[model samples]
Target: MAGPGWAPPRLDGFILTERLGSGTYATVYKAYGKKDTREVVAVKCVSKKSLNKASVENLLTEIEILKAIRHPHIVELKDFQWDNDNIYLIMEFCAGGDLSRFIRTRRILPEKVARIFLQQLASALQFLNGRNISHLDLKPQNILLSSLEKPHLKLAEALFGQPPFASKSFTELEEKIRSNRVIELPTRPQLSRNCRDLLQRLLERDPDKRISFKDFFGHPFVDLEHMPSGRSLEQATALVVEAVKKDQEGNFSAALSLYCKALDYFVPALHYEVDARRKEAIKAKVGQYVSRAEELKALVNSSNRALLQQGTCARDLLKEMARDKPRLIAALEVASMAMAKEEEGQDDGDALDLYQQSLGELLLLLAAEPTGRRRELLHAEIQTLMGRAEYLKEQIKMKETRWEAESMDKDGLSESVRSSCTLQ
Candidate 1:
């Protein structure tokens, strides 16, 4: 809605429609190209009178940044126009609006949904960091969603409700920021250990202690390696090709690992694909891949059991050899616990975590140990633990895929039944 005397600025090619939003210096309008009404955009009109020296410099910097950067998750700056009274910035229009409103509508997001958003945001941040650019004004309101039905994060934002710190006034907020107070994470919605760990690292009050962009990108919870991107399809295709080759070579373990890694990209690629036909084709291919992966999983599991049995004697020897070294012994104990958990046939995710922890410790020990039999034994133990972790990861992914498929099928059946009842 426009004010009593206000009107949208007339641009040469765009027909400005309803007001989208407003700030101190600019008002945004939903607009469409006069030549092609189907082509929609957002026009930010900044009044000439509102331009201070600092703001004008900021506007120039923004224009340059937008022009030089091109990323799928980033909004595009189509063009800019100016008149005596106002300056108009023609930008990509996001139909889904900002993430703040999105989260407000949903109240709380599921952990999976939150992780997807975090991954997208982390991907964008990684790009910006590479270019030595910082998004200083990051908030949920600044992060836009791509669409209503299939939302993709287009910018930075808070994942959950409210800021980690709540203050009643600007002074209070300033004090809190300056005080370097610890951030208290809410416990209402139980989160996974990795998720909590990431939050804690991210919210560290001391700048020196806060998680760096590299660590954030590599964090287990973020898992940016598997995040969907424009290159996801290409990457998945490449990996699957290698996977098939390995499968044909009778390298079941190698093939299974490759297949699991490929699916890490393939699932994301499936979500990234928009064409209905292509999506269906990918879905079909994924089903085939999954079937083969399941077969490979069984084969690999059998082989791993044998390897573990053979390694048991070596492991016992290493434990006895490391008895004098408490740290090495402790790592071996953790590895044993991980093996026990894996054999229990429950909580593959927990087993994977334990295996990772043990490997971390053993690898550190290996790095410092002198060049000797103990070092070699530690190396072997680390390799064994890594293999176990990889296998557990594959098992967890397969179970997740199965659960997702079942959920989708149940939803379809429910919809069909509802339609039948409506017809009756």
Candidate 2:
């Protein structure tokens, strides 16, 4: 409900173009500058009378926070104005509408499109979390679009004071919130396995256990940016070529290992690719490579079975022959990867132990190596892993310092989520 002075007005220095929309707090309009600039901005006007002390403070705090942060993924606050009756916030105009409207109108999205949005959201959240701020409410509805056909999201504040589900009573919603249970989420069928896993961590019921950006950002799903590219493509292709050579020489086990490495490079390349034709070509290569890899796996497995029948287990044979250089290299590489992944979160000391153990295995493997280009590569690999482990340690230490100073609870967060109307 508007106050008595809610009549539409042409404020000085701007021409009100049209009514955009209204919410519990304000009405948004499309407005243009007086000096003939074609660029338009959204003017959000809230009646001063409608704001209680808490609401007024909430608005001020939000404006202050937004002013300090500048991110491509967040809606920009262009300017502000205050009059006797109304407080107006001038914001960036996003013509592409919000994610909620997009989702509602289009029942399903392509997995790639969903992935793009998910990655953007992750980035926005990570940025905010890095700054020690929390959105408190993060859902599709809070995301606005800067473009529609090739959508680019600008994370906005959630619209508060609306029932999430029409069928559920307010009491039921309150009970769930009080108990820290996440409300039922809408189905996003387009999400792939890695994306879904990331979402689960983000939507964790207990805020304390909810994963930080450092943890999920590097997960296989979001880490696609680091996938093989340009110069790395040559390296990846060389690996595949060598695998084929080994297969032709009938060294099936070595071929299998090389094929796995090829896949390691190829998966990221596929993720980074944007051209439809290139992606299809990559898919074809992937299929051919996979078929060959499976054939090699079966051959390797059969050889192990033969060893087992001879009363010497393959695992025992590999362990007894510490001189088996390739076997030792493969095992250590796998173990190192597992150990580093464990250090992704603020776990208490266990991950550090794993990292040390991994480093020890790596060091022994390095010591066993005959010096050459391969040993140099191993040394570089070890240093990279060590850097990651040290970074994780620093992150845990910083998290501890911040944790001790403030409460992590977000249950009673202030009610100041944002809203923009769809109507024009």
Candidate 3:
């Protein structure tokens, strides 16, 4: 009997193999795009009738935002559709499951392994923050692994919490947040200092003082070894195409400029590329671009070469930037996160200590300032740090008292249990 539509629902070009997951609002499916490419894709289907106006608006806004963003660690939205009663989001497929499952299976990963995940998250965060978008949902469940052997993250399913596809007033959530409540993670003593520091910053409750993307990428927790550090293949290919077009038009100098930039982008592709054949292919492209640039440069007049050199060779500017230290930014980043932890009633004296250390560094920088105006600016920052430090002292005391009480309660429970066992 064909009672409740036993056959799978067809979405024209896509063949939905199996239901991947179902939540309050939307259900995801593993699909193959039956277009010219026959590409593997994930399709998120959400019934429009089930979503309220706010949810619909949020979904549209998110889709627009996702369209603008492109990074290896972030999930890609290939296509979208408004087909009849449901909205479908075509996205990249990662079969290795999400980080929550990985965590559940292995408990906590080793710091070495965990570093890769953190770096990927940081990279995704950096990308989002650059576009004035906060992930607001950066948990294990949101981070999907591609494969364990080559664990590239594809941060996904960033809907607003477990769904009834309903949008409720954030009155209760806001009140708790306003009351200096914490967003907590289990304290792992064995975690490395960098890992702990990064985790603390990421979970900082005060949005104003929370970690910034620029600072996060610089934190010691970022081990960029396994990280994908390249422009997308599409970008490099586009640049190459433009370079060739310019060369065809007999614009030697312009062609040389683009070829050089294309070659520049290709270097990182080779550096971070995992697949051997892909790496070699990129290397071949690099060679071709380099040869083209060299030939065009030779054809270019001396005046043209001299004029275009600084403008096109961004690598020169990059080298200069590498030498400059962001000391003030670094100091502020540390102090800000520490102060955030203290204000949120979280960080047990440790944040207080870090704030003091960071404060000291700022004071040192202020003392070294050569100009009066700059010195005044530095002094103002120091004053703000001092204000936070004073507040943190009271919070630290409260935290200590709380910790002691908790310790006593645990000890009392253990002693009572022992006595009961003895009597038995």
Candidate 4:
């Protein structure tokens, strides 16, 4: 609500355009700078009276944070003005809208396209982490895509709030409001698969261990081997854009492969920097490890479906980790069991194989973290896996023994010789 004498500012030459959006605390408008040359921006108008002491601090903090940071992935603040009760913050606009709407219209994006989004979000996280800032809210709604369709997202329009809309039906209007139609250019192959997990980790509930840009760039998942195409980062980005078109048309596997290739190219560029910078390196390294841990934790949290479908890379990586720490191995074993159950019927052979592998990993872990009640639980679980493995092994042995017996009978050997062969 507007406080008394809260009319929007009247810059001498600047033209006040249409209203962009109105939130509980502020109203945003589209405006153009007249005397300073034609520059368009979204002006967020906040009433000082509406802000309590803490709110005032938050507003100032937002301004401070936005002004200090400059990155391709982050929204840029152009200018700010304080007049009477109204404080206006002019920011860059994003015509393509936010990610929430884009996902709604497109439904499920191809894994590759999702990967590109993941990488961009990762980049943003990396940049923020370097500055020791945390983006508390990181849902799809906060992320916007560039509208390259009309004009390449200009610096002015690629980073601001939206314009207001006429009232409409609840459901339709909700979708429209929520839908930013943000275009997610697909990632090249090597990056496509791992980027989502990365962004997800950044969005963790715990601020103590949020995914930072430095950590994301430092990750093995973002390196050269993960890219889908091109010899360089720019070229890989181009390939990702190209892959988006293919993805829109439902060519996902092709799109994913391309994204993976792009990741391969983008990762190496950051490695040397990470290796050389030791001052912040420890914090950055722990951040990466924590993010990775969160990703696996999420998979375990969501259900075994993700792990079962994503394959052994997720489990295998965890296994390598567990080899050094028995407690972690125990947790991974439990995760493997849950995932194995989900894999049942979908691919029995694969499920069984995963189960065996998980059991092997757990057995090794149990060797170290065999503490009281936990040790007993692990022992029980191990017995179950061992039983299943033994059954499978016996089945194979029985088949082999039967085949040999059949062969001997077919040869019509003497009864005594046949019996001897059969007994063995």
lDDT per model vs. reference: 0.76, 0.60, 0.59, 0.50
lDDT for model 1 comes to 0.76
Choose 1 or 3, whichever is better by TM-score.
Answer: 1
Residue-wise lDDT of candidate 2 within 97-124, one digit each (tens)? 7777766565445443444455566666
Ranking by TM-score: 1, 2, 3, 4
Q: lDDT by residue for model 4 over 1-424, one digit each (tens)? A: 3567655567544666666567779987767888656877768889898999999999999998888777666777978888887888878766656665555554444332333344455556666776787878755656665542311111101112222222466787677556656323234222322444554454454556776655667764443233322234455457657656655675543444444443333332221122335313422432342343334333433443442345455446545644766666665665566455543535434545666777767777679764665566556656755654543333333232233323322332111110000000
In model 2, the clashing pairs are none
List runs of model 1 lying over 4 Å from the truth. 3-5, 36-38, 154-159, 171-184, 276-278, 404-424
Give the Cα RMSD of candidate 4.
22.3
Stretches of model 2 off by over 4 angstroms after superposition: 1-7, 152-167, 174-191, 224-314, 318-424
Error of 3 at 344 (Å): 41
Ranking by lDDT: 1, 2, 3, 4
lDDT of 1 at 207: 78
lDDT of candidate 3 at residue 376, scale 0 to 100: 59
Tens-place lDDT per residue, model 1, 363-387, is: 8888899998878887888887887
Per-model TM against the reference: 0.85, 0.53, 0.49, 0.44
Clashes of each: 0, 0, 0, 42
Better of 3 and 4 by TM-score: 3
